[model samples]
Target: MASHIVQNPSAGCIVKFMQGNEPQIAWVMEEQKGKLRLFLPNRRETTLSPSRILPWAGPSYPATQSKDAVVELLNRHRERRERLASEVAPMELWEMAQGEMERAPAEWFAELGYTSPDADAVAACGRALLQCKTHFRFQPPEFEIYDAATVESRRQAEEAARVREAMVCGGADWFRRLWEARIGRHPAPDASTAPEEPVRGRLEKMLRARMRDPETVEDEALWKQVTKGLPDDPHLALLLAMTWGLVPEHYNFWLDRADYESGTAWEEPLESETQELIRAVEEGGSLPPAEDTVFISIDSATTRDIDDAFCIASAADGGWDVEVALACPAWFWNFDSALGKAVFHRATSIYLPEGNCHMMPEALGEGAFSLFEGQARPALVVGAHVAPDGTLGEGSFRFSTIKVAKNLNYPDCEAALDGVENAASPFVESLRLAAAMSDRRLASRVEHGAVIIERPEIDFELEGEGADITVKLRPYPAAPRAQLLVAELMVVANAVLAEWAVKNDVPLLFRTQDVAVPREYAGVWKSAPDIARVVRILVAASLDVVPRPHAGMGLSAYSPVTSPLRRFTDLVNEAQLLSVLTRGSVRWSREELSDMLMHLSIRLEAAGQVQRFRPRYWKYLYIQQQARAHGDECCWKAEVAEENDMWVSVSLPEVQLGLRGKRSLFGEKVFPGQELHVRLGKVNPLRNEAVILDVREC
Candidate 1:
């Protein structure tokens, strides 16, 4: 290193010094043995070695000047320094912008040593400032520009700051005024005369802002300050509950979150298409003749998409001949049409607590293609021969038109089977045959090591709408005689179809679960914990183009060919089957099936999440409501389903409520299958959380 000694240096002299490799200008302030204290162009003071100093070559100024002239020169120099500082590095421009000095006028460039007539130099400096603005937040007025993202960020920050200020100084009224000002409106001079609409609008905006940027409004004190005096309003209270992270009064948010579009009049099948299809069916245009069989459908009373119906009769070879007729939506559905594509994206109908979203257009699903009583509809019929020993024999499928004799619901069928008053008049013989078939199928399934989980299903019905909503929970009646009949016959039909497809080497979607389940599992479970344990061990079923055994259903091969009106996969399968029957081969190849499944999986997963979560939300809401009605200290009888070191999962059988409780309350001895009485508390449906306040052995 060279000796850093400055000799004979005076104050107020412009000098150049080496800072790293580049030379920087400074004014000498004081001197020491080997170093000098100097002031940089930007007026920042620093100490440097004298060896780095050199006399400035271009300019010189006397140590003393007249006061007025000196002042003028200093101002000019300061302006030059500021411009230089801004140009020196990108960080300096950022600092200037952050300090609220975003622009510099053309006159400032002239003051910074550029002549007024040097248009190119002035333009160059402006260009430089414009380039810096790209990297910083500042811009010269001459080269001003705006970016949408940057503008949005600035607006959000400013709005957040304003909200904070309003919250700190004024309560709800002041914030409402500020919001009105932002939207270019003036508040009423008298508070009594203020329009309710504007107040509600302001409340909604604030709630949305709080939800969108929670970090800004996370302070509890600030929330209390801003929300003061607004809770009394019913609408504001509801919004506040949502903003405070509680479940909203209704489940409408799910529709928005899931992007579910409701059925509209315009969404119905085109009038021309409907009329043409109806005329075609009437004239028997390119369709198979009607079948001579008494067909009946079993479903919920509210069901509109009655897709599958069946009839059982004695065969010629001393066995049962079972005929199943599936509504033929595929005959009219155009696979390349926009409606078909929409149905593919939806994948399946969504059944909610309040209503359902159909997979097919209403006009077609419930009217044109529906297998209603006395209506002649086109269908795909599958005929299976059942041996006396409950073994399925030869099966064949065909396309035909069918007339359903009646559409019976499960309850009505059950009542008919039990020989109740008016119900016994219809479908009594069909119910008897269905019961015998179900019993045989159940025995077969049990012999094949299929585990039947008999957990009681709960039906949650919402009466009324919005804030006046009330949820009714009741047992859905698991495996009712009528339900069992429909389920067993549908399974047999699907299995026969799956086997036929595989034997013929046709590409079709097959539901598979190749995992090995316990071979001894059988029968309706008496304990919830036992059923839960068995369920935990079973692998989830998946769908593919290849045939594989479904261990849960106790089938060697299975595919869901029923419910074409409710599921797109079924519709696709129905279409393939129709093509095979009419054109002598399936329409889709393995690659095409795989491609369809790739998109189907994403949509199906999303729909499944909505189905799984939204129902639980409503169920928990019902539980909370019950607790509130009966008082928090009310106890419920629960059976322990599972337990760990810290928590115990309990099943409330009566209410069909499954929840967990801290193990500390019941002690370490708690185990599955143990019955206990527990009090419910801290029930929050929005968060899906609840705790057992107290517990004891029942």
Candidate 2:
């Protein structure tokens, strides 16, 4: 009895017809050459033979003869999957099935290439083969046997893929909409549902109080008191802001807006400078006289448009002579033209994901009035020379039409310095000497006190297969070698400009950066860098040499003149330079320049919003993959890469494993990061989610 009950080594089967139950597919596994054999469950079993299993039963099959009319059918089918699944199989099962099919190959003549079936025909045949074990199927007489099933399966698979892609696409759209709606730039579905309330509290009063004061023109009396007949311009304001000086955005907002409006006044407050601006540009377009003086660097190897140039030569009494020239374009695109109005509405150029947004059309921006090519253009030049050690010497401003050799980007010049050739220009040599002198001067100012910070500049990759954004840090070797050279001239020029303004009492923009206040970051202060350190951060950004520290660079004083291609304030600085040198006057009022400072500050802040979102989302996806690929088998270890008020950063040691291309799931699994794990845990690649199970301190 024990021997008989030993659970027959195999389920020896006999076919029986059942009344209700669906036909059970059982493979007829029999002992053959001491190994198990599997026969097709779809056909009937008969006399056993070494060959001639499935006969050429299909009408489409080749005309071949076989010894047996009957074939073996599987007794108890192990399992069955979807037709498409079986046909496509997984990538791993090709050898076994193909091996079987190759031997005594199917008794059918597969069609030749000259007359080919369409994709649908191929898919239908493939499905039929999976369902009918012998790769033979009963097709409607209306269709070819192979063509029908092959075509059908393919259609089904395609439809499934289409659905999957739609699901993914729809889901992404939903989330993006949700995020945008929350930010309030646009209203969402529920946005308008709120009941309209009666005019209630004084909303305007509060809003007005919060908004910065507007003005038409800068206060002339106040400005002249400060500038002293020199120019008060945009560069000065930007530098002042950099040095922690406060400038409100609303101050300049209304002034720019006034140009497009008619003599009819909008409710917005604007300074007196705004009136000057509207009158100046209300004509066809702003264009200065071409025959006028131009700024040039005639020796650059590969550039067009000489926007600005500087000159440094030995002065009498063993002093140095220096001069800085800047391009001007506001004279062209006046307030009346549609193009100019569009630029005014945009407020300034926009840097975005797809491409750049220029405030002014290229017709003016890179053309006509542009400091492009060998064409002599108008310019406001500021020339100054310090002693051999950078002590402020003789300085003056003038109008000039200088020529430029060629254009060079930052990298081009850096390369030249590294011996890449053609980057250096004879015209730029004098500036280098001036830069050395300026560096020495600024060094001394730092000794007095100024702030300096080293931040990793950021950039991004717009397109790649992944959903998340990634950025590669540009190497420092890319920093332009001409930086200090040009900077010295600009700074001295700016210093002279500012000093002239103060002495002559003119209104102009002044840049400033504030020291970090302890109360603002008190939450973080409670844990990390105490109040003292925070103060250090502020001080490090504020040491000014000529009282205009622009301390963020740890300089007593500094000014920006490079890359006017993108900055509006720099152009404004050029405007101030023009007023001072050419007219011996000041144009924009302190209120107007101050107002622009406010607008730019806001613009800078808004740009940051777009940048931060992409990277954070990408990081989330990467972490999901990290958790999925590694299980809770061991407590994972990682190093601290960053830490802040809310979270600590970590870096894991190397381990070899596939991260399963983003958001793909394998067997059922849990997500990672569910818990604050010092340990290993579950990961879900499908949804880019993670759950931390256990954590071990690293």
Candidate 3:
């Protein structure tokens, strides 16, 4: 039949077909039904179906000819078709074909350009259309002219693909160079030699974004493609960022990992709110009358955000009249505003050996809202009477403008209280009275089954920058006297406020430790091993809306309302207390407070992790340096806290670090309260790992 004859190509007919994207010219050697055996121009033979061949097939030759003759014929035709294809412009043909017809065979397109076209001309037109996929799309027997919109979109996609290829080719070597420079393997590349414009910017942006959030990076595929040859480093993104100068050396990856923004840049959005609060402070803010009493604030020498201060005097009934003035940002804080939400998101200030990240903007936390000395600032004052026997009476809460008379540091205050030479100050009498009150309270707390463990206070400092960073630990001065006085007074104030909240039927967050403790575990513990033994039986304090006994503090309930500038929960509690005192009702309902606490608790837990890990990282670094300098002679005093068949948990009281080792490492006779000298082994700060190499009884 005629249809059967058309279904197969005869032998020696030159056919054009696509192997992949490239068009190949081949000679038909033999035919069986719809299948054709073809010989290509490169002397290769293949079996293909008629459907695989392009519609433009031409000029027949005799199959009985030798292989050399067939190859010569195929090459000659291919050269002619290529020359013709170069002469044809796909866009010109597309412009002429569009709106005239939806699609047509290659002969139709070729004839439009040439009035009398041959098979070679049609085949050339087909080849040109195949290469220009943007304007023309081939579908079997015809070329489809794309619409203007689709053509433009395809043009952009093609350009993007070309640029992406260039970036990957150029950026890989560039990044590896930077990483090499960061490790001091070689000098960094100059700016002139870096990848040009959009490529450089694109790479830097992707690297920084990946460093900040690796888990949710959208360009993970591209990242993998570009960083194919780099080392498999978990902190590779961070290291590359550091090398690229996108971040500094020793950058706190934890902040980025936690999605916490670390600088004052986040404060920009709250400028207007900060200015309003400053104006309020400068113009004597809208609040009740100023309190006449002058309060004294004590903090570390570098502290700037002073949130709590107190003044003591003799009461009418011969008891001590203690007035605690807490920084009152809650008075003007609008929890629904942008500024409020930002503070809530920050949750708490992070104090590291390097620096502090304040929860509130410094303009408010360290300026207008801070309890700076001699400045008239708004405050929530807690007035209560402390009896001679360290008993707290009913408390009175009020919001009023107040001024701090003095600001003192712990070292000077300690020396003053100890009557050391050249440390005399104006508040000697007040200091003595405060110390007496703290002594009485400590005794009372011990009598009430409190578990008090006093461990060493250690401070860490960074000496140099970058790779030469040296961490040094020192004993914290003034912890024995001045720090104790401030700690006790703040506790008294918080307990008083919490008790008042319970009596007034207001919903407030209280820190409760409701577990029972043995009476023998009540006294103060000072030794490293003794403190370790006592700490095992004490329950951790927790926050809740309902009041409950705090076994650790020996109080019925405790609420932290002092450091509003540093802690979000303190600000919240102050808001609750200030609301009832000023507006005569609670600002948040019980359900709302509960829901808020749930989110705040999660944030607090994350913040606690940062605080907990950062110091230990430095401590491990310090230990590693020591071991390298001293070898096996490097020893640290650790007190065993608990032991079982499988493990022995120990505490390094000097560094405030807890560690555990395998039972085999400690031998068979290990017990709690045993102090030992240990040599650390194989410390890797990045992995957060350190092993006890050897141990001996101290």
Backbone Cα, N, C clashes tallied per candidate: 0, 126, 0
Reference-based TM-score of each model = 0.70, 0.43, 0.87
Worst 10 residues of 2 by lDDT: 1-10
Tens-digit lDDT string for candidate 1 (1-698)? 01222234555554455566444556666666778777665557788776555422113356564445444554564456445545544334334443354344433433354334132233334334434434333322232333446646766776667656644554456445534442347632343333354334454555554443444444656656765644333234334434333434563444444555655543664556655666766676656778778999989888898999999976666557798899888877777776777778778888887778777667777777889988888898988987656677656988888899998888878888888855435678767887887778777877776777776778878887665777789888543888888988898888898888888888889989887877656555658788778878788888888899888878888878888888888889999988988898779998999998998877777777677777877877887878878895678889999988888899989777688877899887887888889988887665567788999777
Better of 1 and 3 by lDDT: 3
Candidate 3 residues lying further than 4 Å off, grouped into runs, are 1-8, 61-66, 83-118, 131-138, 143-236, 243-245, 285-287, 316-318, 421-424, 526-540, 696-698
Model 3 worst lDDT window (10 residues): 1-10
Which stretches of model 1 miss by more than 4 angstroms? 1-248, 252-260, 263-286, 315-319, 477-479, 643-647, 667-672
Better of 2 and 3 by lDDT: 3
Q: Roughly what TM-score does model 1 have, to 2 decimal places?
A: 0.70
lDDT of 3 by residue, 428-513 (tens): 78888888878888788878877888877789989998767888898788347777778888888899988988887788888899
Q: 184-214 in candidate 2: lDDT tens per residue?
A: 5564434233112221112122122222223
Better of 1 and 2 by lDDT: 1
TM-score top scorer = 3
